[model samples]
Target chain A: MSAVAKTLDVKGLNCPLPIVKTAQAIKELAAGDLLEILATDPGAVPDFNAWTKSTGNELVEQSEEAGVYRFVVKKKG
Target chain B: MDDSQGTLSLVLFSGTDDKLSSASILTAGAAALGRKVNLFLQYWALENFQKDRIAKDHGVSKDAEPEGASLMRLMREQGSTQHWADTFRQAKEIGDVHLYACALSMEMFGITKDDLDPLIDGVWGVASFMLEADGPVVFI
Candidate 1:
C-alpha cells in the first residue's frame, strides 16, 4: 500500500504543542500516511499516546536518538 | 461518538497552585472527544493562567507533588514548588479548553485583574460559574 509522509518539527515546544501540532498535522493528511514528529521535549511520550487515543489516530513508532525524540503516527480515515 | 453530548464544565478549587496535570487530564479528555469544556481556575491556580508569567521558567516535574505532602522531608528533598508553567501552558494551547479566573477567589486573595494571567478568557463570580456547573460538572 502506498502511504504519504509528513514531518513536523516541534523541538523546543513543550508538552501539548508536540501533541497538538501532531494532531493538527494528522488532521490535514490522508489515511495511511505517516506523520513524523521531532521533539526535544521529553513529555511527548504520554502526551502523544493521549493524543492518538483521543483522536483515533495510530502511533506506529516512537524512539529517542541522542537528545531528539521522534514519533511516527498514521492518520485515521 | 456523539458530537453533541451536551457540555462539561470543570471547576477547580484548591490551593495546590500550579500543578495542572489533574486539570489537564479532565480538559484534554473532553477536548479529545470533541466535547465542549470549561475549566475555571480559582485560588492560586489562577496564577497559572497568565500569558507572560506562564512562559517564565517554572522548573520541571514540580507539579508532581499532590496536595498535602505525605512526607515533608521527602518532599523537600524532592524540591517542593519546582513550578512547571510550561506543561500548564501546553494545556492552554491545546484547543477546546476554556479557562477562567474565579472572581471571589481573586478578591479573597486580593488579586486584581492585572495580577491575573492574560490567558484567562474571563473572570466570573460563583453564580456565573455555577450556572454551567449544574449541567455537567466535575470538581478537581
Candidate 2:
C-alpha cells in the first residue's frame, strides 16, 4: 500500500529557499511519507537531487506540468 | 566506488553581500550532510575572519548594512541568514568543516593572526587549499 503524502507549494522561490524549505518540511514527515513540491525555479532539479542524495531521502516522482515543476519526495531518513 | 572519502573544498573569493552569504549557506549545508568541507576565504571575504571587525563590517549583530548592500537583507532573502556564526562553529566542532584564511590576502590587507577570529583553523597559500579539493571546488 502507498503511504500518505503532504504537499508544499513553493512557487516563485529561488535556490536555497526551495531546498531549505523542502528540508524543513520533509523533517516533519514520518518515514515513507511523500512530499509533493511545486516549484518554478530552474535550479530545483539539481538542488533537490543533491539534497536527497545527501539526506538519504528518496525522490519518487518528478515531472513538469504547465511550466510548474512538480516533485514527489519520499522521506527516508 | 565508496563515497566516504570524498572531500569538497570551496575557495570563496567574493565578499559581496550576495555571494558570501550564499557561500556560507552552501558550506553549512554540505557540512550538515557529513561531508568533509573546507572553506578558504580570500580577498574581501577575509574581512569576515576578523573578530571585532567582522561583526562591525558585516553588521551581523548590529542590524546595519555597508553602504548600499545589506548583508542581512541578502541572506534573509535567501532564507540563509540565520545562525551563521553558529553554523560555522558547529561545523568546526563536528570535524566536518575547516575554515581557513588565505595568507596572501591577509598580507595584502595588512592583517595578522591577532586580527583574525580564533575560529580560523590556519592560514595557507593557494596550493594548500587546493590539495584537499579533489572532488569539487567552487570559486565564488
Candidate 3:
C-alpha cells in the first residue's frame, strides 16, 4: 500500500478509547487515505479488525512488538 | 457490515463500575462501527445514573471484589482516568446513541431527569424500547 497519510498515537490508552480515537481520526481523512495507529490496549487487535469490518474500512497491516500494536488502515473509497 | 442503520441495544441492570466499563466499551465499539445504540437503565443502574452519584460510583461487583479492586488499582496506576461516563459520552458524540431510564424504575425510586446525568436521552419503558430496537440487545 502507499505510505500512510495520517497517524494516530493511542499508546497507553485502553479499550474503546483507542478505537474511539481511531474512528474520529479516520473521519478527518479523505477516502482512500491511509491511517496508521499505534495502540497498547490488549483488546486493540481484534477491536481494530472488527471496526474495519463493520465500518467498511480496510485494515491492511498489523504488528506487535514490545507490547505495542501497530496497524495501517485504508479508508473506504 | 457497514450498514450504518443497524442498532445495538443494552439493558443495564448492574450499577457496578466494572459492568459499566464493559458496557461502555461495547457501546463505543458499536458506535464506531456505525450502529445506533440504546441503553435501558433499571434498578441499580438507574440509581447510579444520578449526576451526583456518577463520580463516586466506582465499585465493582461484590463477587469479584478482591480481583476488581486490584484491577482498578492497576488501571489507576497505568493512568486510566477515563471512566465509563466518558466512554458513553464519546459514543453519543461519534454516533446515534440514546439512553433511557426505565420509567418503572424511575417511579419506584422517585427519580427524575433532573437527577440523572445530562447524557440520558429520556425516560422510556420496556415495550416501546423493544419495538424500536431492530438489533441485538444485551443485558448488562
Candidate 4:
C-alpha cells in the first residue's frame, strides 16, 4: 500500500522548471502523500537530492535509467 | 555538510543576463532544497529592470562578450532558457525566497518602486539587508 497520490511527468523540462513543477505539484498533496516525478534532465540527480534536503521533503526512492531519472518524494510540512 | 547554514543571501550588482542567470540557478537550487533565499539588487542589476523590458534584455558580461552571441543563439534554439527573474519569482512559490532592492542604489539612480519588477519584495538600505540576511552571502 503506497501513499503515492499521483505521478507527474516533467520530462524534457530542464533545470528550474522541473523543480518548479514538482514544487507546485506537491502543494496539492497532503502531508505524507507521495509524488512520483519523471524527468530527463541529467542534472535532476543532484538537483533532486539537494531539493529534498532543503525543502524537508522525503525522497523515499530514486532510480536512474539511461537519461531518465525517477523519484518518489513524500510531502512534509 | 553545512546544511545547518540553510540560508542563501545574494547581493546582485551585475545587470548582465549571464550573471542574473547564475543567480537564478543558485536561488532555485537553494529554494528547492527548502533553504531561504534573499536577493538584494543594486546598481546595474536594479537599473536593468525596466518593467516594459522586464524579460527582454540579455546583456551579457564584458567577460562573455566573445561567446555571447553564439550562446544566446544556442539558448534561443533550445527554447528552454527562461529569464532569471522569472525563475526567481517561480522559486518563491515553492520556497522561502525574497527579492529586495538596495535603497541607496535606488536613490542614486532615481529608481522608484514603480520602476522595479513586481517580484521585488521591498527596498532596504545595505546596512538593513546585511543585518537581516546571514548564513552565506554571495556578491555578484
Worst 10 residues of 2 chain A by lDDT: A14-23
Q: Write the per-residue lDDT of candidate 1 for residues B1-140, one digit (tens) a residue.
A: 33456567887654343345446655654555456677787765665455545545332234545443444334434542223343344445545656778888877767777766655678888777777764867776
**Candidate number achieving the greatest DockQ relative to the actual structure:** 3
Docking class of 2: incorrect
Encode model 3's per-residue lDDT on B1-140: one tens digit a residue: 35566778799999998888889888988899898888999999889889999877468999878888778767867775478888999988888889999999999999988999998989998997899788778998
At residue A52, candidate 2 shows an lDDT of 76
Give the chain A TM-score for each candidate.
0.87, 0.91, 0.96, 0.93
Write one digit per residue (lDDT tens) for candidate 4, span B106-135. Answer: 999998999887888899888877887766
Cα shift from native, residue A72, model 2 (Å):
1.7
Per-residue alpha-carbon lDDT of model 2 for B38-107, expressed as tens digits? 8898987787668875554353322233444564566557753454554466455534678889999999
Give the alpha-carbon lDDT of every model. 0.64, 0.72, 0.88, 0.83
**How many Å off is the CA of B57 in candidate 4?**
2.0
TM-score of each: 0.58, 0.57, 0.90, 0.90
lDDT of 3 by residue, A1-77 (tens): 59899999999888778999998888899999999999988899999988888889999999999999999999998
Q: How close is candidate 4 to the true structure, as a TM-score?
A: 0.90
Better candidate by DockQ, 1 or 3 = 3
Order of the predicted models by DockQ, top scorer first: 3, 4, 1, 2
